[model samples]
Target: MYQSSTIINHIANFTSQRNTELLAFSLLKSVNSMISCLSTKIITVNKKGEVRDHLFFENNHCTVKDNSIEIDNVLRRSFEHMHDSSLAALTLKTKAGYSVIRLLHHDRKSEQFLIINLNEKMTKENDYILSGILSIYSNFIQLLNESQTDELTGLANRKTFDSAISSVFNTRPREHKEVDSERRSPNEIIVKENHKYWLVIIDIDDFKSVNDRFGHLYGDEILIHLAQIIRSNFRNEDLQFRFGGEEFVILLSADNQMECMQILERFRRNVEEYQFPNLDTVTVSIGVVELKKETFHITSIDYADQALYKSKKSGKNQITFFENMLSQGIAKKSDIQGGSVDFF
Candidate 1:
């Protein structure tokens, strides 16, 4: 029912999205519009086969949820035989009509799935049309990723972080950026009273010495290793960004102060114990602050940076909380300084 001009406009709109997640959402919405007879859903899964986010639409109802275990299990069983680059299509005789369901593997590492439920009967012409639409979606996704990802570490770059935080977390004042719920796991949901969104800045201790003693290549490897350890320590839903060089940032949600402390402490310990080849005693200093809806993103980063400064000043390989520093009168709001650490 849609014209060629309408489809081209949708493709243009999808390519303009700033991040991969947004692109994924836009792709589904555009497809749904161009093919009005189809129902669409976009689901993102992690390497562990867990659903991180899902968007489902049908009739006049729409549901967006953080994660669903039952849905994950069902999808896994349904598409267990398909591999990468393969499209699985099926026909179902539902009460509504003779519908078609298509499962598409969007990405391997992320396990993103593009599921479409079409209300029309299957036909050769419809299959060709669907294939063309998916091709456009795939091309746009690749372009978006290239612009947003860090080349070496495979994490998000600073540019991605700047846009992501503002777009994802800073929507409603005092409310955590609710887009996709930003949950760490599908099971972890934000409860108003019991949860806090924490912003953390991680810096490798004395990173200059590593680059100095060993060549830059080895230093680069150390940075890669550090990134791997960080990925292992944090949840997939958490937004992890490599600001530059040895510095990284994580926006995470925790149940409370103790849990927050535990998460950071565990990461600190993990980095302390990891033995990097050709490197001696690689460690990191962390600064953490609970992000509030009213606080500006830059200010939150400064607070976390100040906390990190305290850790580096006393000794590396430790975690410091901004609230604790404030309570102890160690640092004041006006005293926090950004750009003190040399991430380069």
Candidate 2:
């Protein structure tokens, strides 16, 4: 029999978490406590239905197992049983035990699954309880996504930028040996050793003029179109944000300035080539800086802003690197005593 008080406590624990990763752990803990299971896992898959990452909890402790082949096999089997209309959850009898897999959430970006391993098949009572827990988890995830997302573009908003960069700052630089295994997919471009996090600021050039000439409705359409272009050009792992009104920010990993330049330049060229409604052409100016552990977020943004100022001053539709500007004596360190730097 499930204790009402215990279930209430579990709901409270998972709901209290703000971070998605922490929330996932709490959800797993709650499941483990409520069910008589050998192991539990939360597997995340991309839109293509390939496993992106997973968290495995077994024997009351979290662990990592390099068993991709086994995971793939299990997924393949699960897919086979997914079409059974009467089966609320996919149940498979494996060599180790019986496993129950249920869809926790699904969206345009990704899908999440909850898998529980038990010595015996899950009872209907357990399945009912599990459905309740999944409902709560799914609702929490939807709320979190709405809170972090931009209303206009549907990209992440400025509110998420600080925490996202903090995650980058806290990550230890991976070694050469780790790079190969760290890659999520063969097509992933940003996975490399000795790579650094890059902070990019993209501004729509003369966007105010666009609003003046074509009206705010057309201008909004352009922003939405540009956001779609961004989603297509960058990998899903990269952090893309709409920082309000014609300004956007991206945090990505790259081996060096050259690679970063290639990536950004390609984006710039794409923006230039794309035709917008009632406009002949639309272009963007970008400023980029390397995100360092020692640098404050504001300082990093200021540095990129300085390069952006140069780009707007010289000409529109150009890319500028803060390090390049500094080396060329075109830009200097932001002086707090001089007051805040203004963007044009």
Candidate 3:
């Protein structure tokens, strides 16, 4: 009974190895069709531990080629159990003669291996050919990933921004190069879902003072904290940037000028309400504008800047939306007031 069970197990193992070798051979045949001249076979060891999947291509009247000199140094090392089946070109001292060997492991168990012996020689040219073929497509894939991020924030940077805002402003029919308006013009681009995008420029209020009082360490901590807030408040597609020192810019694709203004105001209110160590509260003033696709010039950036300046000039820790072109005029309160916008 014991001998019968062992024999059955051996047969099962042989069948499994043969099946795997057949699959490997089919795959290699497909590969061979693409290459100029190639021959492949899978020499899997059977349950008896002899070659299982057997296919040999040669002129008939063949005896197993057995000549130590003809089969020279190849496959100097046996495969280690720890590794998956791998690829290698091997030359071995065979009974027949020196032949080209490509070793492929069949299974994780290392229970099966494949050795393909070719009647021809494999020069160094063949070894490096496949790698060169692969790199052409790989490099472009790497570049595409780099385009979307600000090197600093790892956030959607400028070029990524160009693509994002184009969705709302419209990617086609682009013509405006100088028009600046109350809403989006030729320069500014806003992504409006139901409405157009609103651009917001946020500056850390009296950030220099924070730097002076607590040192750059604390200043950076504040900056990082504010960045976290920015990340949390916005969606993944909302573009944010560390535009410059103590300044950040964000584009929300879905909101209108009023909605954008309210959003910034809420951020200001949140900052004012939070207490910090060795600090009372920190506030940021923001400027907002709707990006106008038509008649929008690239100079919309400058308009957003002017509005940001107005917020700083009028009072710190407040939200100011761009009305229109500053030359045409950006809206301002009748008088520049002192003190803060009371926390809301």
Candidate 4:
């Protein structure tokens, strides 16, 4: 049996977190504390119920091994079974042992599930408790997501970017190195070692003219369409933000400068080719900078902005890198003093 005080404490702890990733970790810790499970993991899935990625995982014993293929197979089977029935939770036997899978939440973008591996079947009381906890967790997540999301674009709001960039600095290394494919799983898309964080600022070229000619409503529609394009082009793990009115920011990881350039150039080309309502064509100017662990967040933004300035000056609908600008003697580093650089 679970204690009321212990449950209440876990609820309070998770609810107190302002960051979504921190909240996920707290939720896993709470589940581990209350349940007698061998391991617990929170996995993200698409609308079709295919497992896309793992958010958090905790193994309680040394004997348990983390197998991505086995987990995906089990989840696929469990999802199919759940769809065929009216069950809230499903218990299935795996090679390691029995596992319990429950749909924690389903949002507009994706669905999240909690999978717990167990040595034996859970008791009725434990199952009931787990369901109740999940209910609370789902509610909290919905509320938090709304607060952090951009109302118009549905991307993360500017305030959320402030918190996310700090995490990038904390986790990524200062120096860049070559990616070692031998050490990484063939299935893994994001390689942590030698990977670098990139910050790109994208601005719709002459967006003010579009608003002036077509009206604010049409301009808003363009933003929405652009956001959708952004979602389709980038990975689900990438952090996208709307810095308000024609400007957007993307934070992603790439193995090297060449890879990063390719990703950004592809996005640029997509934007150039997109057909917009009441418009002949739409184009965007992009500014990119590789983030170093020791660099201040403000300085990084300034560097990207300087590169953006170069793009706008040379002509719009282009991509520019900060390092390239410095090497070519086109841009200078900022003093980090207050005030904005006038573009017009």
Candidate 5:
């Protein structure tokens, strides 16, 4: 068994350059070869509903192909009747239309399937081989999921951000060219091109008032409600995160700064107007930073945060731009508290 660090180091080497599907196939093949007569395959249908081979494991002189309408039908059926985490049967046929193993997955995203032949003609060796291989495969898939999920908001955590950032940030193809210097670096791995991006950090207005007035449970309820509102209003391109108590972060793309700020302001307005249950009305303060590809994480996060502090200090429930707020004396730190400024 490879140490977790060793596996991570291997993965790190492959970062930005590796074909993740092939790497996943290699991991499956390792488990497959450990069990005789075991083979594995992963298939995914495209946006157009066309079935395609995503990953396949080779057995002693035998191969697995991913293309098949019959397999697609069974896979889709398995998805319908039982959850991806469920243990269930999916009757399927091979490329030549021969009846093959029934498959069950532990996850839908990775689309790993444990194959079994229900035909009585199967040997005990085949059953043992399949069982052992599946046990290992399922463990691997579970690990992948644990890495991607966020504990707080049930959203795609920062662990899932790398690929997402790349698809939207890395614009030019010359960067994709193979050169020792041009390789996918720790930062370069997620570059994409052709759109302005914004990273908006949000904090619920007067969140401590809830904990102080009601209770921690009520505070949590407000957080959950705030999460729901952000999720519903944001576009699919945006990724939402609970950075910690009362704070959420959103990454989104827009054509320009005007559009980005407008979207965030609208989100702010929605929060301001919406009636949260058990509360009169809730408000949020947002600090939006326009992101350039290389300048992803700027000290501007602090600037944005200072802007947010201004919103809270002057008044709650407002959107504050870092540059404008910082230029004036509005963002200065103070030992003073409870005193307030005019509302926007």
Candidate 6:
């Protein structure tokens, strides 16, 4: 059995991890080590009670694909029960094992469920201790989300981008693991040799004109709506950020240059087709650069920015690849270095 002091110290260490996913995994591992009686998992579910991502500490783990039938049935029952009465905590026998489920957090829009597969039936004292641990974990997650998420769009903020990009460069491509299966296929996974990371900077075309023509309140609505479109167009595993002031950033993994170009082109076309209320056609300019482990981080960002500048100069609503720009003799290395380069 773990002492109270030991559990507190372990949770304190969990709060120091770099990102939300890492923090969640670390917390689960710590809890499993401290209390061997229960194996914990954190599952993210959408408004319709569909299991989106499942994180676990187990062997031969069941994923959304592998257990879709069972998961859907379970979620259906849970939701039905939730409608009748509050399901703050409940226990039942599942196909896999005996489990306890708790509503870690919920709003009108989304919910996160905490599922514990019990190794043993708990005593009264054990239940009390487990409840306390869940509260601690919940509070930690709330604070982390508040810090890392953008208030307006709910996308990742700039600080998260800084840490995520640095970690990507420093760590070998092999170190990045696969996320949920619903997001991407096995072929699209990020592996060091096969797939390379690409950075794309997206700028809203004539955004300032829109802000001037309409009120700032409507301008903010456009920003939020565009953010939603960006999220829908990219995979869940991809890193996205509202880099500030109508400029956004996307980091994606692709097998080749053509694939990268195709992806960006698709997004561009989607943005062009979407209609915005009481507004003229809205468009975007994109600059893309293939990120290499050997390249300086700031240089890569600058290259992407330069490509964006080139896109703006040539036309407002096109995608430009940095390597293509070099081949076309449109930009020189000195020109990229000359641009304002700053990091946070």
Q: All candidates' lDDT scores?
A: 0.71, 0.77, 0.51, 0.76, 0.57, 0.73
Candidate 4, residues 1-344, lDDT tens digits: the string is 67789989988977876655456666777778888888887776667655555654444311111123235565776776765674567788878888898877766667667788888888888888888888888788788888888999999889788767765644322122222222322112232577788889999999999999989999999999999999999986578999999999998788888999899889999988998887889999999998876667789998999889889998899999999998999777765433444458
TM-scores for every candidate against the unseen true structure = 0.81, 0.85, 0.46, 0.80, 0.62, 0.80
> Cα RMSD to native, each candidate?
6.1, 6.1, 22.6, 7.1, 9.9, 6.0
Superior by lDDT: candidate 2 or candidate 3: 2
Minimum summed lDDT over a 10-residue window in model 2 is located at 174-183
Model 4 ranges with Cα > 4 A deviation: 1-3, 47-50, 55-68, 72-75, 84-87, 92-98, 117-121, 170-191, 335-344
User: How much is the lDDT of residue 101 in candidate 6?
Assistant: 75
> Candidate 1, overall lDDT?
0.71
For residues 1-344, write the lDDT of model 3, one tens digit per residue. Answer: 12445434433333332122223333333223323333443344423333333333222111121112111123323323212344454455556544454444433222333343444554455434422322322233234335544554454455544544444555332222211111222223333346566667788889999999889888877877788788877864476877656878787665455666666767788878767667888888877766665423244455677787887888777776667534455443323222323568
Query: Using TM-score as the measure, which candidate wins?
Result: 2
Could you arrange the candidates by lDDT from highest to lowest? 2, 4, 6, 1, 5, 3
Q: Write the per-residue lDDT of candidate 5 for residues 105-199, one digit (tens) a residue.
A: 53323334444223233445655544544454455545654666666566656655555545445554432132232233322332235666676
> Least accurate stretch of 10 residues (summed lDDT) in model 5?
174-183
Evaluated against the true structure, the overall lDDT of model 6 is 0.73
Ranking by TM-score: 2, 1, 4, 6, 5, 3
lDDT of 2 by residue, 248-328 (tens): 998877888999999999999999999777788899999899887667778899999888888898897999999999899
Model 3 TM-score, all chains together: 0.46
Q: Please give the lDDT score at residue 186 for candidate 6.
A: 17
lDDT of 5 at 310: 73
Candidate 1 stretches with Cα past 4 Å from truth are 36-38, 44-50, 60-62, 71-77, 84-103, 106-110, 167-193, 335-344
Candidate 6: Cα lDDT at 209: 89
The CA lDDT at 247 in model 3 is: 78
Q: Is candidate 3 or candidate 4 better by lDDT?
A: 4
lDDT, model 3, position 192: 31
Each prediction's total of clashing residue pairs, residues at least 3 apart in sequence or on different chains, is 0, 0, 26, 0, 9, 0
